[model samples]
Target: MSSAGRVPQGLRRVYLNVRPERLGVLIGEGGKTLRDLENRTQTIVSVDSLNSSVVIEAATPETPIEMVLRASDFIKAIDAGFSPERALRLLDEDMVLIIINLKEVIGDSQSHLYRVKARVIGEEGKVRTNIEQLTGTYISVYDDLVAIIGDYEGAYLAREAIEMLIQGREHSTVYRFLNKKVRELKRKRLTEYWKKDFSTKEVKS
Candidate 1:
């Protein structure tokens, strides 16, 4: 398809401007990640190196809206700072993407972005790793954006934790909050499991 054919017949396209430095990460080795994404989502993906823009289009009229949306989401996730591997999780029905724009919080004080991002990243990326492990999420602190990929429960808790950090809440306080949330999530998962098990047993009987 010609680059000028921006709008494929019976299909829609989503254009995203990716960071120049991160473009290689999005493209991956020899375009393997890009091809994998296209195959998984059944969408045509075109990356313009010079412009650092990506175009995602539905492969056919029969293609589901969800497929297109997921593909778009995956690209946006990469733009938002997530690795392509983590971004691919957007394809999962239960996984979600969340991006916190530092500009929203920093307003005109763009300089504050570096400090806030640093706090989330911690001394050696330990804080970020802790939050991911505690909340079962993947986090990426890139440029002026903080990106997260996880299931609904994990994403919600991780997002909250991240916001607290961005707000300059004490690190210890955030750690406690995450610990408490982790237990709550574990309990909820156990309850759901028991309910599902009971239903299965009843059906068997």
Candidate 2:
């Protein structure tokens, strides 16, 4: 975040493990996604399809770890079932990713996981959409996992909202909770805005 567009010259040889199937997403079609990421982050991102690992290396051993890690997070998001486009949002300093493991809550029953996933998904994706709309996040319900992408507050709020649904909480109750969270987030943002404005004025005075 603090690094913004700056690429440091000391970060090197960081590796992250990803699913082999996900390598396609990380590399993108025809390697377009891979090329785009390398260009944007100024680093070399190598995907080993056989081993299901990604190496984020400095193009010149000078690329900063922060940038590499940022790239790593983006790829992780994709591996977690987020689309590559949505994964890119992690490039923003304030963006956060939260993954909820259905297995942890519901145990090893495949039927239970499927049922719980549907519950979070709602009758026709309505529940998922509502949660995303209210929290301003992207939600992915896939293979016993619930993945969310949003700013700090939105991601966690969405995660809890989804978890409640999986936990058998009433839909209406979860909606209400999300509504309160939205209001709280907006108020906090406004407060921060005013504080920043006031600080600027103080400096001028």
Candidate 3:
């Protein structure tokens, strides 16, 4: 048994719609991602498996502002839908996907496909990380699809860099510009990822 003050208190809730398939990724291994989000925003994030919705509970008055902001970020990503093209656009980069219908790249086994994906992701995810940091965008490469998420300027820069890479531009060149871009947007606000306040509680029917 716990004392009254020791018991946890409930906060305001904000709901989000998420695809069933991507739910696991959002939750992560052992709920790692969910826990990270909760710690960072100081909120309680509960997911309803049946409804495919997320409930965010603010820990305090201050928590509501941050919780809503973070919740909005997740909602936007979910609502925008998954498109390698759109993700790159969100990252402010122009990108092209070399669609290979088969699971493996020509002359290589499935393992080869993994290598190619790794090549795009780069060392310790440095390549993708640099792109996101510089352009203030998000880049995710899954299987044969490479998703880019950022604003216009970042997208433009990313597009040029990606095109150059596809055209056989040296990795060094692409990485250099990527670094520069990261510095540029370091303090920039990504409005596209921003969500308006949803702190108000839902009215009961």
Name the runs in model 1 displaced over 4 angstroms.
1-11
**What is the C-alpha lDDT profile of model 2 across 125-145, one tens digit per residue?**
999999999989999887767
Q: Across residues 62-147, which tens digit of lDDT does each residue of candidate 3 receive?
A: 55453445444554453334432232222212322222222432334767656655656688988777666666666656544454
Candidate closer to the true structure by TM-score (higher is better), 2 or 3: 2
Per-residue alpha-carbon lDDT of candidate 1 for residues 33-112, written as tens digits (9 for 90 to 100) = 88898899878999998999988888766556678788988988888877787888899989998888888877757668
Model 1 lDDT vs. the true structure? 0.86
How well does candidate 3 score on lDDT at residue 85? 26
TM-score of 3: 0.40
Which structure is stronger by TM-score: 1 or 2?
1
**lDDT value, residue 42 of candidate 3:** 68
- Candidate 2's C-alpha runs over 4 A off are 1-11
**Model 2, residue 167: what's the lDDT?**
80
User: How does each model score on TM-score?
Assistant: 0.89, 0.87, 0.40
Please give me the total number of clashing residue pairs in predicted model 3.
14
Off by over 4 Å in 3: 1-12, 75-136, 140-205
